[model samples]
Target: MVGSLDWTAAGGAGDLLAPPVAAAVGAVADARAAEIDPGLADTAAFCEHYGVPMEASANCVVVAAKRGGETTYAACMVLATDRADVNGVVRKHLGARKVSFAPMDDATSRTGMEYGGITPVGLPAGWPILVDEAVAAAPEVVIGSGLRRSKLLVPGKALAALPGAQVIALAQR
Candidate 1:
């Protein structure tokens, strides 16, 4: 019976990771899987569910700003220990008077990604992806997998390679 067991079938049955996320992670060298059942509505909930040591995980958020009557997107990657200083750094970087976290519905709709699953990798081209330097320093960091139920463990170098990601010191103490 053990020899006859289908590992793929068994693994697929309870997979919390989405296919796209899995594929993206798989494409990167030195990336590993860290599946979690995070019934995450937001970063805090995600951290809580997975018991991710704050020192090792990153919180990825999408901020929206209206610049010259045009809506712009900013992908902020901050360490779990600190919050993205959206109004301070993000607004200044985007050159917008008004900047805020995009509504969940808007984020999901625009990115075509689920809440708690959005990552800088494989996002639409031309979006500004700002990664906190702290996150980049970690040997391995956990990030959302483009789906809520699972997270992906990727090396910092792999994340920096994602399109348009600028490693910046933007996290608030």
Candidate 2:
């Protein structure tokens, strides 16, 4: 709270993060979670309303693909300034016949998180978390808190280290 963003006043990261996500972030030395208004959940709106820079924001997307009759899911992290290379980088990295953004219902139901508030920290086991190289180099990045009511601020390197996470060139200008 002293050096960081008053984490205590922001409430315990435990309460703000999803159960699995809270455990993961709790282990990271530089991660901070803060409560936010749910109405301002989208990246642009939240950044503008909270006076945070767009460059400081990152988006986590859930991608789905089918390989040999089995459906697989992956979580991708990219800077707000760029889009995830779903059909190109992601599709190839995932090694699937087809790749696309997962349906909203599938994403929420499987991740146990809100539609627009999914984070790479607590994704289902076996699902790869693809992090854009640029995001992994950021000093600090704002990501979803698993719920629409809060946000997580973490060092980019920490995010790139999550289990099954792969730091790659996933962003497209």
Candidate 3:
């Protein structure tokens, strides 16, 4: 029964979304969500089963990079058709020695969302959100609503305007 929720009234499911994400979506004029099975949550399967276009779906990845013996984190969003240039662009942008996907546990716990459903909307305020230019150029895209059982439909501009979010050419191909 998660059909078309305004982020403000998302109910118990709101706990799965980061506090800022929950509030921010409500303020985004075009944000909305629809229910789906948690089992079909990952991008490919969800897209195939629900008939969502791969080009219009964005995947949010949590990355951790090491710089001067410290681990810094960022949430990167790229179109499902492209890959995040983590080792090259991300590491350089973060000024870190190396970068990799965040450990599953760290990502899930830190974002307060399921492993496959972490999104950029409400990531920790300090964790930068890098949205690939391709994704930011789309009119609208489907992203995780912070729960495995739902998906959020939002305008690309809304994502680009998220706190600490930057629109960059973040894709590898």
Candidate 4:
């Protein structure tokens, strides 16, 4: 019911998701999935072509927070209309001296997800998932499926309740 795309139970779309995402879809009881043109995976193209409102889509960004000589990777979820406050709220919350978007290779390889389709779900254990308060307050939100060819739909509360997830004021707008 998100866009013009046909949605089906997430469990039946394993082929459209990365292994980790496919395995974790069961955690969200109302999770649904829809296939889309892989070439349109980027947020702007996907939303425009599929008729999904920008506000209804959430983007998951991978970040690297460094302190001393150690680096910690975390995922940040924010609505498409907002930007994650990586250098401000996120850095302080992560207790890192510096915070930036993770390198593309590191983000994709570590999470076992595609660069453009990373999602908070199925992330490696122990990694913090910072979800913007606006994202968690949405009635329903669309997010990545860990595969460029598909997207996942879930209730906002389920995302906030994911293991290691912490809802906070993480969006700049």
Candidate 5:
């Protein structure tokens, strides 16, 4: 069980999310394992090195949107095979006139996750974590672990349980 296992077993950076987020995910049954790899700067390179099939991987991206002059963050989960329709679904979902991918600096700074290794698990609690319905339908999904070299293989359901996660049809075919 997650409680019995030393979560600190991998002694590097701690969970990216606050205690409650990790606790909620840890409470789920059969949550997949997290593996740390060497730091990767891009998705294709990370997938090749880790032998992770691109089809089975879900890419998590942080998009910034302005609603009523207030900036907000939305965590969009898209399949590696598909891209998040930021201008379409994301803009409509957030009711923003304009939205754009957050700058690299902003993403890294806020997430505590390196460029290519951002995962939904430990994201800041308030951000809306949207999962592409396709990802939720998969048997197993590979995702970032808040570290460039690390990844977590979790069941779709477990991913849905993360705090503030919403399953939506937000991926482009």
Candidate 6:
């Protein structure tokens, strides 16, 4: 119901989710999953092809923060119409001297998800999931299902309740 896609209980659609996502979906209340053409997984493409609004779509980006001799990884969720304020809000929030988008290969390997489908739902334990205030306030939003061929529909509040989730003003208009 998020767009033109047929949505079903995410807990019952393990086949469409990554292993970690399938395992973690049960923890997100009221989450729904819908299959889609993998080729249209990108935000603009998926939104346009499925008649979804940009405001209802959220993008999850992995960031690397380094301080001293250690590096930390975290996930940032923001509405598709906005952008994550990485070097500003995220770096300061993570308490890192530097912050940057994680390398695609590193992000994929560490998160165990496809490049374009990494999501906050199944991120490694202890990694923070920073959700923008606007995203957390939305009634519902579309995010990747940890796979390119499907998407997950979840209440913004549910994302804010995930373990390690922190709602803050992390998006730049």
TM-scores, all candidates, are 0.81, 0.92, 0.89, 0.99, 0.81, 0.99
Q: Pick the candidate with the highest lDDT.
A: 6
* Per-residue C-alpha lDDT of model 4 across residues 77-105, encoded as one tens digit per residue: 99999999999999999999999999999
User: Which pairs, if any, clash in model 6?
Assistant: none
Task: Flag regions of model 4 displaced more than 4 Å.
Answer: none
Give the per-residue lDDT of model 5 (tens digit) for 1-173.
Answer: 22111223222324533332344446544555444446553667756765667787789999999887889888999888999999999999988988999999999888867777777877777889888898888777777666664555667777777778889999998
Q: Give one digit per residue, the lDDT tens place, for model 3 in 22-82.
A: 7666655567676778899999998888888889889999999998889989999999889
- What is candidate 3's CA lDDT for residue 87? 92
Q: Name model 1 segments beyond 4 Å from true.
A: 1-23, 40-51
The TM-score, computed over Cα atoms with residue i paired to residue i, of candidate 3 is 0.89
Every candidate's lDDT: 0.71, 0.84, 0.81, 0.95, 0.72, 0.96
* Predicted candidate 6 versus true structure: per-residue lDDT over 41-112, tens digit per residue: 999999999999999999999999999989999999999999999999999999999999999999999999
CA RMSD of each candidate after superposition: 5.9, 2.6, 3.5, 0.6, 5.0, 0.5
Model 2 over residues 29-129: C-alpha lDDT tens digits? 57777878899989898888887787788999999987899899999999999999999899899899899899999999999889778999778888899
Candidate 1: residue 163 Cα off by (Å): 0.6
lDDT at 23, model 3: 67
Task: Judge candidate 4 against the unseen true structure and give its global Cα lDDT, from 0 to 1.
Answer: 0.95
